[model samples]
Target chain A: MGRQLLSILLLAPLAAILVSLASRRARIAEYATVAAAIIDLAVSIPLLLRTLSGSLIFAHGYVLLDAFGVWVILCVSIVYALSSIYAVGYMRLLNEEERLPTFYALFSGFALTMLLACVMNNAGVFWIAIELTTLVSTFLVGFEREAESTEAAWKYIVVVSGGISLALLGTVLFYWGSSFVLGPSYAMTWAALRQSAPQVYPPLLLVSFLLVLVGYGTKAGLAPMHTWLPDAHSESPAPVSAMLSGALLNASMLGIARFLGVVTGTSVSRFAHAAVVGFGIFSFVLAILFIVRQTGIKRLMAYSSVEHIGVQALGLGFGGPLGMAGALYHMLNHSLNKSLMFYGAGNAMRAYRSKEIKSIRHVLKVFPVSGILWLLGAVGIAGAPPFALFLSEFTVLRAGIGGSYRWVVIVFVIFLIIVFIGFLSHFRAMYFDEAPEGEIVPLPFTAWRTLPMWLAFLPLLVLGLWWPHGLWNIFHQVFLSVMGGGQ
Target chain B: MFLAHINSLQASIFSSLAILSLLLTFVMLGSHWLKNYVYAFAAQSWLIAALSASVGYFSGYRELYAIAVLTALFRGLVLPWLLMRIVSRLNVKREIHSVLQSSSSLVIGACVVMFAFVIANHMSRQQQGAAHVVILALTIMLSMKFLGFLMLSVRDEAVSQILALLVLENGIFLGSQILVPGMPLLIEIVILFDLLIVVACFGMLVRFLVVHAGTTSSRELNRLVG
Candidate 1:
């Protein structure tokens, strides 16, 4: 049953790619992708529920459907579904009817690679999957074919490919280290690495882990290495930006988390955690600085992505059940909330014919219902209460408070307030500030545009209000599987 | 472990091939012409393929022969061919905009090699017997990586950047051949094909860069900023 669901979950996107490519009309291609994304989301939820009871291995152990991996799959599928629906409304605005088929094809292909990256069991194969994601998404990032878009695409591929080669090297080192214990011919599976971790030389293991962290951290948009992100995210069409933030970063984080799991109980574990914490804090501080002085609206959201990814890294580096749970929860919430924010930003960009926040004024006058939802989303994403991010961020903070990095918790809280102020100030200007003596023309309302925001906003509100018991159970099981104490 | 069991002739053969490949990376770093970078890359790929086949022969890993053939066909031949096509399409021949002089960059590249050697020396100290070959492999692998990044930072042309990325992948591939020859055959093969797809994608993007951006040099492509 689990295998069937996994097959369907993967095959749906493959089928969508074929159908989209075969179709001549833009509407058919768009609808086909939306259908595929919905099917994937439907399949992934059950897969996540089923895998929580026990991990499943398939295809000679090259694919793993464990609780931790399935949770990431769930996040990817959610973003895929939301973004595809949002893309239907968003791409129509681009007026490139002839190229829409190709766009949808690459979009589904990008989704397929992120999903593939989630379930890959072999570390080497996982690197390939992540690399494939970069390859596919570079086209998507450059889909607009503008000067800036192509430049962003160039930087995205170069930086990410260079960064992940470090990950490839680290994986080789890991396999070499394990070879000393498991012979020269063993599979480089996550389980094999974990089994051989304690026996590998401490210095080798530490160096390998740090290399992998920096490599995957670059992909996941951690600071200092996040130079490509604002350019790529802000320059891509909005739905693609949504998917890049909402799906792709989480997949890369899955790689880092799994690697952390392998070295969890080793002698280098403390140093490993501290290094993660250091990167996390650095990313957080850097993002805060950028956000405060940000100009472009989507770039604001991009930097916020860096900030939240930092928080998730902080959670994972904290290394307990609570920390893991909070990080996983933050992944889902950030996906939903970031997608909502990008959709609104896309809508405003189309209506006002500008990408600057200063140009978009009186949002309630323009969008009315969805505008209110966007405003609330901005508040929610700023780590305000009655929204899901606040809950997850608070949980991550609680996880840090009693730990060795309690000082990081204090730093985390202070910046949380700063981020709250900095992020919402842009929204405040957009929503409440008067326009500079100009009549802003609003675009005609489409359910395609606002429906996903409503879909995303409702869940963000509910998940904040009620943290589900089933979710707690799933998080606990994933924590056990990732941190290595349960069967 | 594979290195420990190999005889001195095997070790020397591996060491020389590895050093030659590392020298090719230096040729890439020191040259001003984009064609030289591509040629150096092709030579380095061929040398790594030779290294892979030799490692397979000495270590008795038969699958690496297949890997060697693929690396030669794809990395040594097809990738450079594709990159050469990208270069010929562009009007710029030599790196017209230099972030650093070739002489200075080559000096920095030497320093990077020494730095990689120190790290490799530290890492290989943990291993027993035949440690020098492991150290050599690790050093070449890492130096290529550093030199690749150096090329990326110093050269503004799109083709040069693409070659730098290929150099990075070559470094990893060369290291994996020596250090983990028994890594799954499927993975190595897929990564080879994956590299082909990457270059093809880069080829298309370079076309897009030329058409849409009007310049392939990143110095002119800087429209998007925070």
Candidate 2:
């Protein structure tokens, strides 16, 4: 049953890609896309339920399904579903219906590659899947066919492909490092590799993990390796931008987390922890610095992504039940809040006909619903109460202090405060400032367009105030998986 | 006894081919003509294919031979043809626009090769079975990978950047030859497929740049900044 559902989740998108491509009408392609997303969400919910009951491993270890993998699939499908709906209004507003086939095709392909990256059992296949995500999204990034968009796509493809190739080298080295212990029977399968990791040579494993960290870390928008993040995130269409931030980064992080999971019992884990923690803190600092200076609203959201990704990496690196669980939980919260923010930014872009935060003013007066949602999203992502992000960030902070990383915790808090202030100041100018002189702006709002934002934001509110038992149980299992305890 | 003799014969051929390919990479790095760059890359791919075939002969792994054929078909012939078409489509004059003079670039390349040799020596001391030469191949690829990086940063043409990325991938492939000769065929296929897609995308990007911006130099791509 699990295998059947897995096949559906993986293959449905491919089928949609084909059907969308063959269709001539934009409406047909859009409907196909939304249907595929619905199928994805429908299939994954049951899969998550089953995974919570017990882990599912199939194809002789090619695909492993635990609560964590299911949780990621659920997040990805939810975002993709919302994005598909939002893309309807976004494309029609721009009158880009002629390009719908290509957009929908690549969108489906992008979602498929991300899903594959989450569940693939082999490290080599996982790396390939992540690389494929870049390939698909590059075209989507360049969908505007404008000079800046094309340039952004070019930079994104070149930088990310280069990074993933390094990760590929690391995967090869990992296979070599473990061949001594595993006797070359299983190749690079994660389950087999993890079983043999304890006996693998520490030097070789350390080298592989470092390479993997830098390699996948680039995809995850880790600082110092994230030069492409802002450009790609801001240039792509809003739906693509949302998926890149919300789903794709998490997929790459999942790859890194799994590698760390494999190395948990080994001596090299300390090395991995230090690297993750260092990169996380560095990214957080850089994000705060960049956030304060950004004028483009999408670019601001992109920097915030870097900062939140840093938080997750730091949580994972903190390496305890509280930290790891909080990291996983934060992944969920960050995906929801960040995607919602991008949708808001999209609304602002449509209304102002520009992405510059300084261009448009009186957002609250012009489009009250989107304006409120946008402001609330900013407050929500800033780690305010009544949002899941606040709970997750607090949990992570507690874990860090409890784990005796006092200095790091202090810096973390300082950076968080700075970023929170950064968010408020940037949006304050956008929301309350007067409009540019004699400039008239048209309002582009509809119930259908704004519905997805409210749909996504409600969960953030619900998850923040209430932690249901089933959800907590699943989070506990995922934490155990991260700690290398559960299957 | 027969197998032993065949192994030595195979080893000599492999060594000679690897060395020749390494030498051709220098020609690639120093060439001022884009056509020469393409030819040098194609020749290097052919040599890698031959070397893989010999590795198969010596190790008795049939999959390596298939890898060799795929390399010849895709890297050696198809990719070069695709690149040549892109060159003509862009109407690129046969001139390389690099930041450094030829003499200095060549000198830097030589220094990098020596640096790679030293690292390879250190690594080979801990491994086995002519793996030192393999590591030598690996380091040469690494240095050339740096050369690719140099080309990317120093050259003005978008096509040069594309060729430089191909150089980086070739370096990675060469390193894999020595690092894990027993890598799965499935992985090799996927890597090749990825290369094909990247090339296609690179060609499309170059064409787009030329059509829209009237130049293929990435230096003009500065509209997006902090």
Q: Which numbered prediction scores highest in lDDT against the true structure? A: 1
Instruction: Output the number of the DockQ-best candidate.
Output: 1
Steric clash pairs (candidate 1):
none
Compose the digit string of candidate 2's lDDT tens values, residues A1-487: 8889999998888888998889757898888888899899899999998888788778766778888878889889988888888887787777787888888999999999899888887898888888889988998988888888888888898778777767876787678667666653345877677888888767668867887898999999999989899999999999999999999989998988888888887888777887898899999999889999999999999999999999999988887777777888899899889989999898888878888989868888777787788798899999888999999999889878876578899999998899889888988898887668765565556665788899889999998998666776787788776567521
In angstroms, give how far residue B29 of model 1 lies from its true place.
Answer: 0.7
**Each candidate: fraction of true contacts kept?**
0.83, 0.39
DockQ of 2: 0.43
Per-prediction DockQ: 0.82, 0.43
- Whole-model lDDT, model 1: 0.91
How displaced is residue B39 in candidate 2, in Å?
A: 1.2
Candidate 1: RMSD over Cα atoms?
A: 1.3
TM-score of 2: 0.95
How much is A185 displaced in model 2, in angstroms?
5.5
